[model samples]
Target: GAGVSQSPSNKVTEKGKDVELRCDPISGHTALYWYRQSLGQGLEFLIYFQGNSAPDKSGLPSDRFSAERTGGSVSTLTIQRTQQEDSAVYLCASSRDSNQPQHFGDGTRLSIL
Candidate 1:
């Protein structure tokens, strides 16, 4: 509600199970982004949505990963047929615009068994 908010701070699922992570950005932010952080790795950009423009999916690791922003306020990241390699902290960030600094959420810790 105040800053960026992510659902289910932690998630554990069996391999091959699909999972969806949600992000609720600040009230008026126009830019939303999704990133993944492996154990010691830096944030890996996954996707970006700005206003009504087309989302930039260039950073997505595979076809099984997808994300969408709705009504310019909320976003969802869906991972299909999850694998062990997919286990990581999924982070969400939002900014007033693409040029502005972002506010990050605590992130969802996903574990694949």
Candidate 2:
């Protein structure tokens, strides 16, 4: 139950609301990644956190989206001023290292009404 963990498998919110999605990676795993998949769309990379290095935030679409990893273990992705376009499945994955294959958990489905 520890390869990778995500909370609140599904969430529903009104437009303009803010939400936080959480991820807990396996012990000793130093790399974490976030992705988003919309209905009928391919998954898109959102961010990456590797060890103690600065997180790679380039993949995030806008300022409204951001993520942070604390103690290189758990991560939280926050979406501010959510929009209808934000409705999608938010996936989390982790790897022992950056070049290794990552293990993913069931994603959190966010719905904006």
Candidate 3:
């Protein structure tokens, strides 16, 4: 497909476990973004990467959350010591540039027990 794709569309894990979610962006897209959706929390931008370089990571809430990109195409979001509060829908979006509109993937639904 020529759009963003995310793996493990749904995940169920116990509290304190670590989880890794992956996202593959459309071909030739240089900008990728990660966002989280929680009940009452709304859509929150987590991080962004441009051409394998992340210029703004301030959106990441804590050290337990981190992300990285490889070959400027794929990105992975890792959460350490997952908590029930971490349960949310993690979304991935891609754009040609910051000024361009982004296309999103079906978010990965994370459930922490």
Candidate 4:
């Protein structure tokens, strides 16, 4: 079973551009989480989705950040009008439950110039 996976391990883009990062969680997992990690920093919770719907969207930093999970499995984080401030490693994780340990994917590192 795939624990979790992300794409474009590294991405570089100009400011005001848009980017999409993908995540694939482990099978049968019902909880998905999105987090951001700046250089030399800890993971910052972004949004949380249960099944295929986002229930806790409190962590989205700004309107520029949005995400969606479909079929209760695959998820995508889309950044609109990307900015230098948006540069960070986007991480996705999933767990059997909120209290359970989440398995994290490598992450998608995005750089804005």
Q: What is the C-alpha RMSD of each candidate to the true structure, in Å?
A: 1.3, 1.3, 0.7, 1.2
Q: List candidate 2 stretches off by more than 4 Å.
A: none
- Whole-model Cα lDDT per candidate? 0.91, 0.91, 0.95, 0.92
Per residue, candidate 1 scores C-alpha lDDT tens digits across 1-113 of: 58899998999999999999999999899999899999777889988899645468898999999888879888989999999999999999999999999999999999999
- TM-score-superior candidate, 2 or 3: 3
Residues 1-113 of candidate 3 have per-residue lDDT tens digits of 57799998999999999999999998988999999999979999999999888999988989999999999899999999999999999999999989999999999999999
lDDT of 4 by residue, 1-113 (tens): 66799998999999999999999999988999999999766779999999988989999989988999999999999999998988899999999878899999999999999
Runs in model 3 deviating more than 4 A are none
- Regarding lDDT, does 2 or 4 come out ahead? 4
Which stretches in model 1 have alpha-carbon errors above 4 Å?
A: none
Using lDDT as the measure, the top candidate is 3
- What TM-score goes with each of the models? 0.94, 0.94, 0.97, 0.94
RMSD in angstroms between candidate 2 and the native structure over all alpha carbons: 1.3
Residue-level lDDT for 101 in candidate 4: 93
Which regions of candidate 4 are displaced past 4 Å? none
Model 3, 37: alpha-carbon shift in Å?
Answer: 0.8
